[model samples]
Target: MTGIAAPGTKVAVTGAAGFIGSHLVEALLGRGCEVVGIDRRSLRSQTLARLHLGDVLDHPRFSWVEGDLTDLNLNEVVDGCMYVFHLAAVPGVRSSWTGFEDYIASNVVATERLLRACREAGTPKLVFASSSSVYGMVDTLSAENDVAMPVSPYGVTKLAGEQICLAYAKRPDSRLSVTALRYFTVYGPRQRPDMAIARILAAALTGEQYTIFGDGTERREFTYVDDVVEATIAAAGVDVPAAVINIGGGSSVSMIDVIGLAREVTGNPVPLTAVPAQPGDVRATAANLSMARLLLGYQPRTDLRTGMTRHAGWMRGLTPHLLRTYAPPPMITGPKEATCSH
Candidate 1:
């Protein structure tokens, strides 16, 4: 948590109101660094309010900009900042199938604009929030150097964004240094309601049937959000000009097993209805953390059971009506349908 950046140094977080971004902003402020948060969500948006940032939202060290990354004045956002964590993107795989244009604008074009502004402002470091989706369906644990054969449009845009960062870093005159972290299945408190764990928890709490897109056998490396934030902060301190590293939980677990664990944690056995596998949905994803260890000394601390238990506990405290309200609409298959978190 310490040595994230110089104390009192200004840092900018693009998706400050998001689950992971909100955690990162809080951590940075706790470390005595000033944070400039940029998000398209209005101050009154439920997304921001539900985070319960409270004092952190009004902290003297925190300032928020209510605007999209595409239209924001990037130069001003990065001005006098030592680091920038680019986490803004139109997240979710299911929605990306029909919303490719929005994905490109948020993930690709917006990243290019930020990189250019960093180059112009001489920002020292930028940690891009890449995703394991970029690896698509891999035969074994995905490494940083593996071919980025992204299967989904969301994955494609994220890969392009990372490429843009590297392209800028390779410039002879560029002063900005970039580190892209391909996070695998990040989850914990404040997880988006649409994600697997959150949905499972909600079903357990409400006695509702949880929909499983595929059989419970699909596996994923569920990295905890706190561990991811640690890796991200560590990435900024590294000297790498341009490097891609995997930020994973150091292990993988089956979706069915996760459901069982949720039942044990929440003490509620929720019914599950399995559906056919959807397009662009990978059967498995695991990350090789060697590069992350070498570069950032990062190691995931939370196990799936422990993390899921915490998520269940957080959900138990929320009002039942609010849980239902946050749940995304039922999934229907079509060329436009897609799902999953980044």
Candidate 2:
């Protein structure tokens, strides 16, 4: 497959300050690409602090446009970009129950507007960061061909994202192509604080009780952050039709097993507690990476233990209190102050 990126290639990323987005930006810069990023968090704000973006925050090749995708000039983010990575959107299955409106605005409506912008800007490709939740509970491996019966509002919105991409790509006059990656339980250093791995590691650091929502046997295909980032870049580079592909580590393990890895990595195990499973929580997830391999030449290289060790080591550098006190940026719908460096 032909790849599009090269040194000095222009790229745009939404959710630039986020866990995966931050890592992607750093990787692109490492490849000598000039990157423009959009996120709701301000560079000067300490509220939504994440250590992942530290390396690229001041890199001359990186410029951040601050604000939600809906609030920003969509063309400004995607214009003249060879590839646009659309990773913006609120995440979490449980919270989707209560915050459905925010999911619609961020995940669905913002997506349509961004699609329009990409079409108008004539961007070659868009890589959307979708989720494994779109498959609901899968007894075996979740495939791109699986019936996407998303159990939560968040999943529904993500499926909406994939559909919207297909819809636009098929338009007779459209120039924008899209690749939607269904990431299966991405975990690594600076993972979103709400994710189980991050919360478990944080609890380990603080010696707090890490609660498991259900019996700890629920399993996930926890792809490493770096692996996810690699697949994302490949999606942008490989010349392929607009498609949905799974990005996973190919190793599925239980929550209890991950906790064991954390203990081995950190040498400090948090007290584990359990409760009945909540609504929309899946029993297990494993990704079918066949399409990723065939289409994007993707292969996941990180094992769970090694990935956990790297994650633990990265978190050890920061203050312990930062993990225990993370507040998600307020879900934005209306236009906020959109001024920033271009």
Report the C-alpha lDDT of model 1 over 119-142, residue by residue, as the tens digit: 899899999999999998887999
Measured by lDDT, the strongest candidate is 1
Give the clash count for each candidate: 2, 0
What tens-digit string does per-residue lDDT give for candidate 2 at 182-242? 9988888778776778777777877777767668898888999989888898888656667
**lDDT of each model, Cα atoms only?**
0.84, 0.81
- RMSD to true structure for each model, in Å: 1.5, 5.6
Stretches of candidate 1 above 4 Å error? Answer: 1-5, 47-52, 335-338
Model 2 root-mean-square deviation: 5.6
Residue 175's lDDT within candidate 2 is 76
The TM-score measured for candidate 1 stands at 0.96
